[model samples]
Target: MTPPPMITDRDRDVIERYADGATLQEIADGINLTRERVRQIVRKHGGADAETSRAARQAAKEAGEQRAQIEFLAEYEAIASNLAHQGFTRAETVSRISVLYPSIDVDVADEALRASNIVFDQNNDTDVFSNVALEAGVWFLLGSELRLKPDYAWAAVNLPQELLDELGTHLSEASVTPDELATVLGIIGAAQNAAMSDPTLTITGARYNELRSELLDAIGLKSATGTKPWPPTRQTLQKRYQGWSDALEAMGLATASLGRPKGLLAFSEDDYANAVIDFISAAAAAGAEPTFAFYGEWVKEQAADGTRRPSPASVRNFYDGWLPALRKANAVVAARSAEANLSVE
Candidate 1:
């Protein structure tokens, strides 16, 4: 009753193979049937198959185990770029993701992290420090830059619960209190700022453990066995962060945002400049001082053909970067016009 033999040809082939002294396992392998099913078929065809030779069975068992191991490994990949983009080591991104997605086993995450080291070596990348000294050195400099005490006396902040929730602070981490949450958030900002100041300082070790150990050591924030101060684990950082966006938001710093930042226009830089100047000139011609709202309306109308390309934040940046240049140009034009009039007179 092996699902009602739908193919007579396949059944005949199995019977012939069994009659030719093939072992049940060999026939099953070739015909894609379970060995017991093959054995039953062989018994039905007038002669019983021989017992599996012990040595062959052992080999089959090893082969099956090897196959399983190979398949299990396929559950994760060890690519370097994959790890860097995830920032697995510094942020405990893997652990957090595992918490978020229950099926992602920790072993798989570890394998992926280790694989990144191999990939990093193969790719000849130096984004991560080659030695603990360098990583520690970087951490000391970064912590100093932010003026954070290894003990969080002068530099701690306290956010309300709503902001804490928005920052993704889970209850599990010791960051339950506001000062605790602020201390870690401060560290994250400090790290980001340090990376900005020196691109090499970007966290790049293949795993969070390496980063955690290095940073804690450098800052003398020992965990579990030191006299000075205990440091936050990578897990703690993850409890309050979804990445730079949330980190910045939590700290009340400027941000690009989860979606597109407000006020980025599709206009080319030159077009954007012209629109700003035109908006200002039009406002002046109307005997009204140019303002951010007027410029926003100009951007809205110019980009209205299909989309509002420039976000408000980006427009604010444009105003910040180019308005002074426009003012300078206007001043120069006025000076040249005055000189020409004097010469003509």
Candidate 2:
């Protein structure tokens, strides 16, 4: 500014070197200035030229975003392809989507279809069975649903937009109707709930009962009691118990037994408790007086509290009422089978 600040020879030399393609280090060395100082000077004087650095930085950022988008699309495509192969209905796909992406927009199906790169023929039925695609579709759809849901907004924001578009397209082509999709979704949701409800014990009480019945039938036990004139000794009971135990073991159930002669058979605390109730009911229906003494040792082992074994009288009162009904049902079945055989002859 003061006389336009006399241009020093050193500055002129530095400028000349720079103009000749000398690097900032070379110019700094020539001017005896730090590289940083040289760069600052270059930038200050460069004016419009400084925009090159900013533009480069912006380009790098955009490239990163693009790469992310590409990756997301690839992943989504893979997942959609898998679900489509698995024969998952559209409703199942949507349900999986809702589960994975709760914040997904209601209109995602249309949007995804529009954005998908996958091509399908008009004749390509969505109902066409595909095990692999169905499985993969469920997972991708889950992700898509998560993307639109508010709760998954953060995930949606992080996901590349291209992926979202691709997923939308893939989902749109699914043949499964919305209602069918909902049922599948409900099933998946129920399974998840069941898993969460008891991570350690997945079998339900009803399932246990069915398994128990199957095991009993396998061991030739018409009922828990030996009333069918089958062997009733301790060894016979043990053999039957062992058979049931083996079967349950195969099914991964932990089993145990109690009782001496005509004693009560106990499973685990949970299983045994329920079995006892069932036994009492069965006894009442069978016209047999249920006796606690019949299961005295077993009950005592289960109680472990040293309470006196329940009296035979007490057992009879508890179970005597139900035996008659069961006996009648048994007689009816036997007679029907006999008549059927006679008719066949």
The prediction achieving the highest TM-score against the true structure is: 1
Cα lDDT tens digits for candidate 1, 118-184: 2111121222222222222234334544554453321122212342353333322322456545565
Best candidate (score: lDDT):
1
TM-score of 2: 0.22
Model 2, range 54-73, lDDT digits (tens) per residue? 56556766676556545444
Candidate 1: segments with Cα more than 4 A from true spot? 1-147, 150-163, 168-182, 186-345
Q: Which ten residues in a row have the lowest lDDT in candidate 2?
A: 224-233
RMSD of 1: 17.2
Candidate 1 global TM-score: 0.27
The TM-scores of all predictions, comma-separated, are 0.27, 0.22
Worst 10-residue stretch by lDDT in candidate 1?
A: 222-231
lDDT of 2 at 70: 59
